[model samples]
Target: MNVHTAARIVPLHENDPRSQDPVLEELVDFVGYRPNALLTMARKPGVVPALLKLLGVTLRGDGLLTEPLRFLVAAEAARGARCRYTTTHLVHAAHHLGIGWDKLAALPSYLDDPRYTGQERKALAIATAGGTLPVREPAQAIGQARQVFTEEEVVEIVSCVAMVGWFNRWNGLMGSVLEPVPSEALAHVPWLKNLEV
Candidate 1:
């Protein structure tokens, strides 16, 4: 695994609590909670600014899924690809949303795990199979997802996975560092230490 520390860069726009609209504040908090090493790297070259702008538009417009669900989809994609940096970030994102480490770890096993609800199981199966299989296989997974999610929601979920997969590939290829999870969060989620590729 790569051990280089990621250098933090300033956000293009100030994250002042007073200056932010309610929705923007929520988005900022969500981003702040996750250690996105890839975004940090991208910011150094001005890529993050453009990406954030696009994300802002998407979030404000057609992103039909909730923030936590989008994060979950990305987490599944990152885990399946074994991209440590992306996985670590997504894990932290899940933690921020009150998801337990055991639940996060069991994501890969959700299809067969009795603990998952039918909808949760279906989403996980779709995410897992979509990550591991080609686009064609994801058609079946998408069909399953449609049973639980609206067409727009399913598209957002699939888009989240695809975006995470792209970031995971880049992080792996660039040998990005895995930032440690926050100490407070780590204390509550010991299973994170045992996470496997």
Candidate 2:
């Protein structure tokens, strides 16, 4: 799982511009804007499609995890594991989803944070703890999540956490370097300066 550093990395070309779809365009934009190890891995034959499919399943599914929460889980997993590159990428993505860096910074103390709702606290707690703790007592926490999300949504939360864990391990092991998010976007997230990761 070595991180590819080819100067001219190749990725899938967009389909005909006349047939340009909004979803496809957005995906392309995301990849173009954030060229990371994941995107580099995706450029390999037979891997990009599978990665896209997984993303589709997560985004199009009827899961309880909101877009913000999904991004947060990825950010937290990267942060908790000290995966600097992944953490910064996820934090930037979370910011794009309108999740403030302050809120993300306070995630570790979510249980006592007044800014987070009961359901949000539960989801954050589950993601943060589940990453490190083997035995997760999610019954009560899941119950709280149920108040705001469907069973499918609960599954999404768990899946997002798992996805983050997987990527964090991969990125950390690979020693990926942190790429600065565009300065304009970074400026909007003042709290990012305070993030230790």
Give per-residue CA lDDT, model 2, range 1-197, as digits (tens).
23334323433334323223454446657634533455455445555456556766664334456687777766665555555556667777777777876776676677787867877776676566556545266676677777777887778877776766656665655554445553333465454444332
lDDT of each: 0.59, 0.59
Alpha-carbon TM-score of each model against the true structure: 0.69, 0.69
Query: How many steric overlaps are in each model, in order?
Result: 0, 2
* Model number with the top TM-score: 1
Instruction: Write out the backbone clash pairs for model 2.
Output: 63-153, 64-153
> Residues 83-189, candidate 1, lDDT per residue (tens digit)?
65566677677767767767766776777776567876666556676664454477778788788889877766666776676566667566554544443434554
lDDT of 2 at 24: 44
- Cα RMSD, each candidate: 5.3, 5.6
